[model samples]
Target: MSSIEIHQFMCRKDNFGVLVHDREHGTTLSIDAPEEAPILSALQEKGWGLDYILTTHHHGDHVEANEALKARFGAEIIGPGREQDRIPGLDRPVVGDEHLILGEVLVETIDTPGHTIGEISYHMPLAQAVFTADALFSLGCGRLFEGTPQMLWDSLKRLRELPDETMLYCGHEYTATNARCALTIDPDNLLLRERATEVEHLRAAGKPTLPVRLGQEKKTNPFLRADDPDIAKAMGMEGADPVEVFAAMRKRRDSF
Candidate 1:
């Protein structure tokens, strides 16, 4: 069993600030530095000192508090090697497909560009979780800001290859909106409908609807199901390439 404990909280409007703690090793790390105050509060509450910051991208909202947290906790920042120059106080630059051991836990970085040209996702197999910062969301994927639809689609495909039981921890709390858009594309999906209702209730209760299972996302998230014939048909593009279907869905979501 995994001994790692994960604490997730909202930061800077919709961005999520996450802390991954290994109790046995007394190692505590954060996913991204969305803000400094809340992160510090969380660390204090948990009585854990920050040891590392695992950055998924170089976006301002994601890395805005990098230097502040580093200065306060002396945490080492590890980020995408491809965008190392963009991230502040980056001590370790890692590329996709590279494996590193931190606090006795193996961390695998998966290149998930499309949200940004150099975005990456951190996957911890033993912990059964993947932090897909901006590359993928619950029922939607990030906007293609610096990459092509093909690039985003390919990145999502790689993420889909993870174990079905793996939990997905995304960068933002956009499930409610994404769920609404997902139903429009896959209206006939019974699972999607159920998930949409669930999302609505979660938001109404002001609860986080994240850490969703990859298996559930694969069945309900339209972006991940772009290749499904039913989804393609729903979009009026039957037998279309998965990338084309994915592109159409992303474009529609952009305006949604």
Candidate 2:
């Protein structure tokens, strides 16, 4: 059986640029185009040509290098159909709850609108990985830039349904800050405390705190635990609707 390889690197200060490759089919694609320089560098270092660009949203920071990379590598650009007009050089607009195949790998498109109205996440069950972009993060989630709190909470619920073993690849490197905020919300959570300590050490060591397992996030990420009774109790909102608790948490996080 052939294996898949992922190249994750930092771009544009805190954004992440990821390249997913299928060794069996000699197919390689990028998750997002944060910057041309870093994307080009990572591709060159891997000695692989880019075949496709899977865009998660229309944010400038994420799609700025779309045209450049496409022109350079003649790669196909796929993005959210709802925001096709916003994404530059979008060759294929994909909607949520759709599936496509790249080589022998199956790619599942999940609707995750919150930070952006048309944001989507890419999940590859075969690879046991999902690229969540700004919709979901290690210990937090994206701010409500273009969507509502309800929209974001709904989107997160969909993500939480993903298998426990799935690895989450988000668009930014804000885990350390998120950890601090998470502790404020769930101070008595031993797992969260330990994870926060781990995040601190990782950031201190100049290491990336990404590709966190979904199982870990389910237990530690406050945003994902909005429906948990314990989470609601911690927020002094016992029996409150999950969405209400989630909104309160998001509001607190905004200022945290």
How much lDDT does each candidate structure score? Answer: 0.93, 0.94
TM of each candidate vs. truth: 0.99, 0.98
User: Each candidate: RMSD to true structure?
Assistant: 0.7, 0.9
Candidate 1 per-residue lDDT over residues 60-82, each given as its tens digit:
99999999999988999999998
Query: What is the Cα-based lDDT of residue 110 in candidate 1?
Result: 97
Backbone Cα, N, C clashes tallied per candidate: 0, 0
List model 2 lDDT by residue over 1-256, tens digit each. Answer: 3389988999999999999999888899899899999999998898999999999999999999999999999999999999999999999999998999977778999999989999999999988999999999999999999999899999999999999999999999999888888898899999999999999998999999998999999999999999999999999999999989998988888886
Q: Count clashing residue pairs in model 1.
A: 0
Winner by TM-score: 1
The segments of candidate 1 whose C-alpha lies over 4 angstroms from its true place after superposition are: none
CA lDDT for candidate 2: 0.94
